[model samples]
Target: MGATAIVTRFAPSPTGHLHLGHAHSALFAWRRAREAGGRFLLRIEDIDPLRCRPEFTEAILEDLAWLGLDWDGEVRVQSAHLPEYRRALDALAARGLLYPCFCTRADIAREIAAAASAPHGPDGPLYPGTCRRLSAAERAVRLAAGEAHALRLDMAAALALLPAPLSFAEGGTRIACDPAQFGDAVLARKDVPASYHLCVTHDDALQGITLVTRGADLRPATHLHRLLQHLMGWPEPAYAHHPLITDATGRRLAKRDRAATLRDLRAAGRSPAEVRALAGWPD
Candidate 1:
């Protein structure tokens, strides 16, 4: 394929140190961007000022550079780009696509419990849209009064806007996300203005990214991201979700898991290439 402004990014939050899963995700994006003769970029998803640490962000860069990963130009940090996210939020809110949510974590849990079938994954419980019943006028009144609220997308309306087959190219294969499979995703949290789903989609568009490579676990998320791209009037990029590196117990690597963290592995004498190989990444 010709280089159609093919760009890729590795946007990790500075909440913790870099781990195997992150390594795999970064390597795939870096490799594909190079192979396509496109630009590779790094983005710091550090908007969660409460949990994100400056030390951890610094460590992530050190680890990636140690692994021989190089990114182009100045890095993009979500915290540094607040105006952009707020602009998107305002635009969506203006279109009546975003709703103010007053529900807390416990409130969401009560909803899932009431539903009687709780399924847990890497991203946590699926929201049942408990706060969506509020009228747009009511939502505005609460927001104007300074009541803390999150920004959630109107899923039912958003779905109708997507085509039957949401299409993209991945590893030269045509991939499509069935609109029926994705539910409503919160675009921004009250704790911070940016959610992963929202930041990823908006930042990709903002960065002019055309290709994205990450773990297979995010395969499901691609649909929602694509749906969001359509709703937000942003272009969708080609994506490839590679297999995640699991431990001997078959559990996927986590940033907090000491065994899988690059710092821990490097101390144990594993070469950077060995770390990549163990994660099923190309040389």
Candidate 2:
């Protein structure tokens, strides 16, 4: 935030072993920050306590160290930062930018299927504001009775008050977030502290992330984070969405892609150079 050239972070949720796509993003962020004489940090997005495992987190640190990438300080984990997420959530809620979403996964899926029966992209269904239209009295009635509901940012409410023509750089694509392209994205997982969209925005700014490098598949989300930043009075950083390393089938490698995982490679006696080269990155 001060005189630092730039600050970038590789925040991997330690749910599984680091795979090819993870390596690409890590190298891209590490190189980008280093080239700019900036600080590179590591953050463990372990907010999903249900899925996060300490063993996987340790493996990530080991793999990154093996890859010759170093972070500036002790790793920052999102699970340790719930108070921060809560503070940001409260701030946004006070501003009327976020609303409660009572729809469950199945309910949402049905609504989405109905919408997509007409037409929709791979991003999933548009939230029909089933909860958005709920009056304050109605919401409180449900809340008083102990209803489980996640929080979602009101796209219409946010767009109406915020500036338009929002855009972000995706490799070379000037991907923009039109009001119609995205729906009310969940911010805080109901009952849970923070969702990915909310935490990423909060942590990126709080941790002073200068550049964000992730898979191109998440290109559409840059806009959501961008808008959230503005609403929360957080600074927006430069972003780089790298191409995902995929298999011969054109499927992007994931943690379940066992053959591409660092563990599998290491067990196969693959050197650091060879492992990085698998993602087309230099050792």
| Candidate 1 per-residue lDDT over residues 85-116, each given as its tens digit | 88888987787777778988888877898896
Question: What does candidate 1 score on TM?
Answer: 0.88
Query: For each candidate, what TM-score against the reference?
Result: 0.88, 0.91
lDDT of 2 by residue, 129-237 (tens): 7899899999999989889988888887888877556766545566666644667877888656788888988888888887788888887778778788777888877
**Clash totals for all candidate models:** 0, 1
In model 1, what are the clashing residue pairs, if there are any?
A: none
Cα RMSD (angstroms) for every candidate in the order listed:
2.8, 2.4
